[model samples]
Target: MTIVRATFLDTPTGETAMGAELRAATDAALRVVDGTIVERGAWADLGGRHTDDDVLDLRDGLVLPGLVDTHVHYPQVRVTGALGMPLLEWLDAVALPEEARLASPDYARAVAREFIGGLAGAGTTTALVFGSHFATAVDALFDEAQRVGLRVTAGLVVGDRGLPEALLTTPERAYAESIALARRWHQSAGAGSSPRTRYAVTPRFSYGATDALLESCQAVLKDVPGSWFTSHVNESQAEIAAVARLFPDATDYVDTYDRHGLVGASSVLAHNVHPTDRELRLLAGQGATVAHCPTSNAALGSGLFPLRAHVDHGVHVALGSDVGAGTGFSLFKEGLQAYFVQQLLGEAGLPLGPADLLHLATRSGALALGLDDEVGDLSVGKAFDALWLRPAETSPLALALRHADSASEALARTFALAGPADVAGVWVAGEPVKS
Candidate 1:
């Protein structure tokens, strides 16, 4: 058992409603047994109560819940700055060519190291990663994620058309490979009930995946009891048009997936930047989550996210780095970018606060990936997945943090200036992965 004393900040409870407030504990302590937080209170009070337990003092800077990334590609970690092109063009010219190279296990292993290192280094303890087309590459990703103890949900990227031939797989192959991978990593022994890693049924997007492939994807979900489903939806006008052309009978892009029974409580669709009200209502009614990749939207010339509309429609939304198309692995950058995009939207925006940004980065993501009960916050019964933001003494972020008048201001500065370099420590389930 260990007692962690820190100046903690988080959005501990509630939905991502407007005017959400931070749960700040300037001199707080958490009693951790194994990996779960058993108790929490003021440092002076909790410390006196747990006198014999080991103590981890982190009062020098702010400690926040471990960041959660709902949508990021394991294969695109090497193509981060392949800029200057729109979505389809960039995927064809830059991203797909690099992803195809993962067919080599050794190369996939190397990329896995860099990708996992990037996530851990950036204080991201939980992520819903988009995996590679090759089963070997996905295995490499899961192996590295397990080795590092990051909470990951990923699977093979299956698509039949529109991508390179090497990346394509028939519906039969997709089902077989997906179930096999899930059984190994997600359902090993009786671990399926509470596995550290989980599987996600990832179809690249509607444009690339055919009806047969989607039906097979639904079959994979039915076979793997606790598996998740993720894919792209209405990201750009061109993509939406293409999806419409492909699925002429469907009502909209969301319908293409919905018709196959793919959208649900466990589904996390990325980049619904241009979702219609009908789609939003459908998603909300079905209890699905949308990963709003703000940076990726701006970078790919995808339109501003309809955050206000989604909120009004009762849809759940979370943040994603969408790395490569996005800047990097920092949720702070994503949060700041989310704020910027909202500002650009003017009255159409949600006008987020520091608490809103923090919520989106942590709890909202946990909710999206269906891990809220275990890892979203520092409440009793939740795991000790957290990060310490102790910037270098001489750094500007450190200076700004010191002079901040309130916890809210400190958190605002954190989103504005802090990055991976300022993350001094990271813990997942009470075990230190970085320090």
Candidate 2:
């Protein structure tokens, strides 16, 4: 058994529902048995109770829940900051071309290593990754995640139309290949118990699929019990127009997926930046999550996300790096970006507190992925997925945490200034990762 004492912070339930309240332990201690968190409480009590256990002290640093990134692209990791172009044009010029490179099994394996390394290095313990087009490449990604012991939900980016010729998959082929990949890795490399990996049905977006293709994806979801579904939604005007053009009979863009049975409790749609009121209501009622990608939205010149609008409607919200277009994999950057976006929106934005920002980076994402019962907060029953943060000694965040009068002030300062490099240690399911 091991014991770690630090200044710990988490929001047990979502911050929005908890009145933006923070659950803090100024001098917190955690007890781990095997790979599970056996106890978490005030350091004074747990430290005295577990006097014989090996101890790790984080005197000045903060212990935060391991971050969960609900949306990111595996193949586009190298294409970040292909600037000055909007969404569709960037996909045509930069994104798709880089994704096409993953057709090589050898190249895919190499990219998978960098991708998995990037996640852990940035303190991301759980993620919903966008997988490569090729089954061999997707396999490499799952293999790398298993080897790293990272929790991931990912799948092939399937579509049959309105994409580069090299990336297209026929409906029959899409189903067969996706099911085959699921069979191989869906149960944490098919290990049969509490596996860290799960499969998702990821149709690239509505514009890329016909009814035939999307129906096939729906079939995969039905075939795999406890599986997930995800795809892009109203991220850009041009893309939304394209979707409308393709699905003329549908009530709206969200309805396009609803028609195909892809919008539900198990589904996560990326970038609802342009969802109409009707769409928001539908999403909330259906229990789907929005993988909010603020950096990607801003970088690609997509409009500001009406985050408050979704929250007010009771929709589930989570963070996504949406890398390549999103800039990087650091959930800190994503969290900070969220703050900046809200600030830009002014009063129209959600009145997000420090605890809410941390919740977005950690718990909200887990809840969105339907893994809340297993990971997310420092609650005793959850796995010990956490990070030890040591900001630059003289940096604003570090100095503020040193002098702040209370936990709330320290947390606010850390969110305002800390980055991934500040993460001194990362643990997932009680084991250290990120080298």
Candidate 3:
């Protein structure tokens, strides 16, 4: 057993901040223990706290739960700047073609390394990622995540129809491959002693996946019991119209997935820009999560997400970069985008504030992925996954809110305005993955 301590900030409830200071600081000490955190009257009574472990003092840097990106495409990393088209056209022109390359194991493996490295470097430790249609691509991502000791949930993109032919999976093949991959990687252990990888059932979106294909994906969930289902819903105007045309029998775009048993607690539906009150109510009733990709929505002209409405309705809303369409891997930038998009819609006024943004990036994101209990916070029993930010001498966080130039600057601004940026290191499951 080992004990490492530092100034800690965590959100015990979604609304309150819990801060603690340890007398002796040890850098990344949780990597050694196994078992639960013992409670000691509002504090964790660490039973076997070791005093001799290596120490890492963040020098008062802000250490919060590692950022969680609820939505992103691993294969789209190469097409970051492809612009102008809406979701459907973009998918046809740039996204699908690039994803087609993942059919090669070697190519998939190399891309997986880059994707995970990029996410980690940006302080994202947990992500609900979408891989190419190739099952090998999903496997490669899981393998790379295991190597880096990051907590990742991903799956094969099951677009059996309407996608580029090279990137398509037959309905039967999609089901078989999804099940095979889930059984192999979902909840699989990492290089460490505990399970670090999980699988989600991905159907691309209603437009790309045929009714038969969506059903097959739902069937995989029924078979797997606890498998997660991820898909795009109500992202763009064209996509919405396409879904209505494709599934005329369904009342709306959200219903297409709901009818297919794709809407539920373990499901993550990206976008909801055009969802109706009824759709939002259905999502809330079903305990489904909405991954709000504000940057992507804005970039693709996907319309502003009704964040206030979703929050008022008690729907679980998390922030996602939605890379390629969303533009960056940093959840901090995603938070800033979310804040600005809502402001543009006049739904909320600015100085949207950093604490709220941090909550969305961390706790809210984890909740969306059904991973709130394990990650998203710095509680003693939770996985020791966190990012240490080092602010510039003038307090970069403060400068960010007013004069931010880059995503990193925005993150520093988040810490300054709402929290602090003393990130001297990052730890995943008690192991220091970066410093």
Q: Which candidate number maximizes TM-score?
A: 1
Mark the regions of model 2 whose C-alpha exceeds 4 Å error after superposition: 15-18, 188-194
Report the lDDT of model 1 for residue 148. 89
lDDT tens digits, residue span 1-435, model 3: 444444444454562111211122223333335422222121133423444544444534456678899899999888887778788888888988888998899988988998898788778889989877887788789888888988888888888667777877788998888878877886642233227777788988888778898889889888875678888998878888888898889999889999988899998899898888989999999999899898898888888788777766668888787887878787877877877876687734323455567777888778887777888776656777788766666764534534765434444366435322334566787677776
lDDT of 2 by residue, 1-435 (tens): 988889888888743422556888877888988868889888899889888999978766898999999999999888888888899999999999999899999999999999998899889999999998899999899989988889989998998998889999999999999988898878744544338888999999989999999999999999988899999999999999989989999899999899989999999999999989999999999999999999999999989999889988888899999998998999888888898898899989876778888889888988899888988888888899988888878877888888888777888888777877888888998898854
Which has the higher lDDT value, candidate number 1 or candidate number 2? 1
TM-score of 3: 0.86
lDDT over C-alpha atoms for residue 377 of model 2: 89
lDDT of each: 0.93, 0.88, 0.74
Model 1 poorest 10 in a row by lDDT: 187-196
lDDT digits (tens) for residues 101-196 of candidate 1: 999999999999999999999999999999999999999999998888899999999999999999999999999999888878884426532367
Better of 2 and 3 by TM-score: 2
Scored by lDDT, the top model is: 1
Candidate 2 TM-score over all chains jointly:
0.97
